[model samples]
Target: MVVRDAKPDEQTVTSLAAAAGTAPSMFNAQPWRFRYLRDAATFQLRAALDRTLPHTDPHGRALHLGCGAALFNLRVAAAHAGWEPVVTLLPDPYDPRLLATVRLAPADAPDQELARLHPTLTRRHSSRVPFRDELVPEPVRARLRAAAEREGGQLHFPSIWHVRAILELVRDAEGRDRATPARAEERERWTRTPEEARTATDGVVEQVLGPYGGYHSIPVRDLAGRHSAFEQGDPTPFEEEPQLALLGTAEDRPADWLRAGQAMERVLLLCTEYGLSTGLTTQVLEWSELRWPVRDPESGMGQVQMVIRLGYGPPVPGSPRRPVGQILEID
Candidate 1:
């Protein structure tokens, strides 16, 4: 649908922000704000610090990535609306709050790719359960990698040994968090019981909780009670065989994180289109101690930005998203 008539208006900003909300955050934090100048038809976005994950993402790297993902969505929506989005990343060094500025440029119709991927935004939810034994074909892998590259990141599927090392890193991180006192407090604060009052506009929820009592390769971020009925069956062989893809960038920066976020969303949306379920795990990368070594020396792949698991499985139920009106303000 067209977001603007003769020129950019409130509708353009509203539609773009709603579309952008589909981009994933580290914890689905959806931390961002958009300001539209009607006369200039310029859309400006900034990171919403209140949604920042201070405990896990102190550097604001993930926050920027989340915002960047939203920015990418804005571009796509603009294209779908027959406009090319002109974006300036981190446009003003003095005003770091200005993450990006996008002005719509006139364009023809949106292509089939945009049309196909558009619907997946609302349909795409994180799947935390172990995927069925459906092997992802190399062609599918190549397409996912292409999706990442389109938004300026690289997707790498690890070799067997590399996958083993990555799994070990994840296990070590999970074990460390399970023991730390701060981890307990953080989890308690962010994870709501099925009946608990919801917090702010962010975080994983009980519905996205992985099955309990298992060593799954792509474990869900535990949000449910230890004994909740939502938990999956006993840890089966599928636990060791989850599909994994490593997302990376040549250089790491705020802009790079933003690119990675967009790439991430693209990959996830493409997965949804392909009838593949998907989830993300950044636990190991969340700890700086564990992230650096993820770069492979032999292949020259840079440090990993996101670790995603994908396969055919049931889709997770929809989670909460603040109303479009709530996420937008017009002046």
Candidate 2:
């Protein structure tokens, strides 16, 4: 496919790809690859088939979601660099791994809206630590909801009852994961031991996983694997009243997952910009039986893409990312 777009410099291309690589993914799986067409000036985003979390993310939905977040970052970075990025998703049915393509053209003017988010791309980290028990103001909540809508998604702050139900679902899934043979295999596959984390560039490293027990029915995924929900360290008290937001799309499909991923990162970056700490609660969302119940029955929202925890807290280290040379290629 050809478009009236200009090719970016090699240095600029790498910088943009670096920003894209920072987008959050399931388990920090970072299941995305990039190919820059030197002659055509187009970039292709692909799903690294090997990085799939088979047990937790069957059907490659999480792969698409993670790649979608990376696509969003690529756009933001391109915009910041005074180039307009043209994107095409799933361009070839025959090439299922090809998630998207980005072509950059010099912009007549800067996209300030997207450009403003550039600083936040690297600033956002998935904080697994305990957040202070404080309520997010209504104005801030409204801004987050709007951010989701801008990218074809909805963000709903659940009622107290709904929050309780979702938490229960997460606990149920974690219990099953502990007992299921395949789940154990998958968990062990991504979890790096404390000693192993120093060198490993991906997966849930021991450094980022905070602790074992927590209070208030918090739905944080127990990545502290020692054969249980949480078996690593002392109990860490989360917020007494945890604030939860569900990001959803109107439909459930590969394309919808991509949009939702973009929306999820947009929300996360905004949260970072607003000086708020956040963590993802996908334990319930990962399981099909539990994911649907996460939606508030009263709400008209569609498929729940992600569940986000928002509040004030210490910004803990996030999972490591693969090297750019490993994930991106220039042709």
Candidate 3:
């Protein structure tokens, strides 16, 4: 059997890291790190304990999900680079921080489908602005479900009363956060001011924060609400009718969260490929009470991991990523 070289060159490593680094995280915390073993052509994904948002992601499930998204991007990057990526999740039983490992082997026939998604990596960003209230077609939704299912997760589109329940739960979560000073502090910690955003490497900045409601009741998380201490955005009208999808997995475990994260990213990327804008909110899911009811009583979707908004909308700037040098170690 032919084998790949023991070590990939600097350019290849940087390119792959750049793609993987584009994955979305809770509040853009980017709670993940990477280590490439040059001698073995393996990339190890580890949790960035320093970057964890403890209050919102108390159990590190969101962190694992973000890391899984990064892992998915890494796989796509590898396939585009003519390498076969063999991945193992939770390879180490004792080391909880070590999330996954990917071994890259040279591929004579690379994954064409994954390679097609290479361009979408840069194009896929969370659209925080208002999307047209038009419903996504059933066929398009089916394709999105296929994307999620391929990654060991499920996606369901909920309209009518289901949408009302979700929106109310999000408002409830918002009210709960407002009542508690500590919960409000979570948004403050990850939100960036206009000045900070100009040079900041991470966090939800002013431009993408969208704005507070004026005439609409969308469920977009307002990260910059506490302007007395941080920058706050002006009020803007959002779509009255938002198309929503619930992405979930069969089980609720670290591994399941990771799978949901991958499925989430895959669905978003596929959405981008179809020229659709997407945004995601986990606000209700952070609170257990609101989280349980997020499931559709009409259908069995396991544990609802993420609430995703999809539609046609104007593009927003992608959040900045930490320099590859900061998150990647080659040795």
Query: Model 1 compared with the native: what TM-score?
Result: 0.89
TM-score of each: 0.89, 0.95, 0.95
Candidate 3, residues 168-270, lDDT tens digits: the string is: 8888887777777776788788888888889988898878777566323467876766423224345566887788999999899999999999999999899
Better of 1 and 2 by TM-score: 2
Question: Each prediction's Cα lDDT score?
Answer: 0.75, 0.84, 0.87
Question: Candidate 1 local accuracy as lDDT?
Answer: 0.75
Name the TM-score of candidate 2: 0.95
Kindly list the per-residue Cα lDDT of model 2 for residues 19-119, writing each as its tens digit: 99998887787898899998877899988888898888887877888898999999999999988888888899998888888888767876788889999
| Models, CA RMSD each | 3.2, 2.6, 2.4
Native-referenced Cα lDDT, model 2: 0.84
- Model 3 local distance difference test score: 0.87
Clashes of each: 1, 0, 0
